[model samples]
Target: MRLMFLGDVVGRSGRQALVTHLPRLIERFRTDFVVVNGENAAGGFGITEEIAEEFLDAGADCITTGNHVWDQREALVFIAREPRMIRPINFPPGTPGAGATMLTARNGARVFVANVMGRVFMDALDDPVRPLEAALDYHRLGSEVDAAIVDVHCEATSEKQIFGHMLDGRVSLVTGTHTHVPTADHRVLPGGTAFITDAGMCGAFDGVIGMDKEEPGRRYIERTPGQRMTPATGAATVCGVAVDTDDRTGLANWIAPIRVGGDLEPAVPTRWETA
Candidate 1:
């Protein structure tokens, strides 16, 4: 099974790039399922119902979020109704949305996607490891589900890597997000799970993590308050990882980082070039 996991979508630029290029990506990669991080899709904050629906319409089977999941306010209610939209699994028990969900791909493959947030350098929540273990325990890859994906929305690379190692061999892929900077560590782990320290943000590369550079630049330099940061309106590069998994074992056989458009050089999995 071929699965694609996109990084956090920043703002208008990220959303536009995703809506415009995702279908083509699915076709070119022969993707059976797609998951995207939409935590920053609503103007560099939380995701809104409309934007979440847009991602779904653009072919994303599931959308995951991090600490910013509630920035939009309306998300608190809409997320409960939308099963495909997931927030951090470590949130308090009564949280509005789910932390994991099962989605059927277009080819009839069942995919279990779980979203977890790292506690280091972020808000204190339930231990992520337990929730992730529970999700994996509930859905046995290669038996109950054709594919299992875990999105570790985190700030620290160490924490993300730890989770990847912890879930290796149990899940098809474990990719990180929230840093807005793609790392070069995309590789299949010893346990067969595809892992990347950070999948990067799907937004303009020229800005400061998808926001306009002026305000952030000034604040850092002057150490003084400035106008609110806004999303960069320039061209964006959709960033993510593409994983090809074994149908029988539900383990990743190939993994590649994808960066398209904008300032970042384009990258596509060569294994799919002939497909």
Candidate 2:
């Protein structure tokens, strides 16, 4: 199975880029399944129902989220109905929406998608490692499960890396999100799972994450909120990772970083097959 996991979509720029580029991207890569993190899709804070549908219409099979999942109250209502839209599994039980969903690719392969937020340097949520373990065990029990993708939404790189190691080989792919800065560590783990520290943000690269640079700069320099930070209205970049997994074992065969347009250097996935 060939899957693509996009990083956090920041605001209008991110959404616009996805709508503009994702369709072509999916065709170019021949991706079987696409997952995008939409936590920051609504004005750089939370995602809205409209934007979620836009992402799905643009070729995303599933949308994942992080701490910003609750920023939009409407999400609470829509999440219940949209099974492909997932929040952090580590949230308090009964939080809302399904944390993991089984999505079928166009080719009829069952793909298990999970979203988990890290406890370190973030919030007082449940242990991320535990939820990940449980999700893997639950899906691996059935032969119907073909691939598993885990979105480790987090703040600390070290924490994400640690969890990646813990889940190495157990899941098909483990990609990080929230930082909005794509790391250069895309690689197939020794255990065969594809991993990346962070998939980066799908917004302008010339600003503070995805927000306008002026407000954030002012807040940092003056230690006061002079104005509300808004999403930078500029050419945006779609950043993330692409992984190819073996059908029989559900392990990664190759992994590559994905960065298209904007200030960041361009990156494309190569056609490589492992023996």
The alpha-carbon lDDT assigned to residue 75 of candidate 1 equals: 97
Root-mean-square deviation per candidate: 0.9, 1.8
lDDT of 1 by residue, 1-275 (tens): 88999999999999999999999999877789999999999989999899999999999999999999999999999999999999999998998989999999888999999999998999999988887788888899989998999999888999999999988899999999999999999999999999999999899999999999999999999999979799998999999999999989999998999999889989988787775
Go through the candidates in order and give the clash count of each: 0, 1
In model 2, residue pairs whose N, Cα or C atoms come closer than 3 Å (at least 3 residues apart or on different chains), thus clashing, are 180-201
Give the least accurate 10-residue stretch of model 2, judged by summed lDDT: 266-275
> What is the C-alpha local distance difference test score of each model?
0.93, 0.88
TM-score of each: 0.98, 0.96
Residue 65 accuracy (lDDT) in model 1: 95
Model 2 agreement with the true structure over 1-275: per-residue lDDT tens digits: 88899999999999999899899888887889999999999999899999999999999999999999999999999999999899998887888898898999877899999998887789788877677677777798226588889999888999889878988878889899988899988998899889999999899988999999988998888997577689988999999988888888889988988899878888878673332
Over 4 Å off in model 2, which ranges?
Answer: 272-275
- Relative to the unseen true structure, what is the C-alpha lDDT of residue 250 in candidate 1, on a scale of 0 to 100? 91
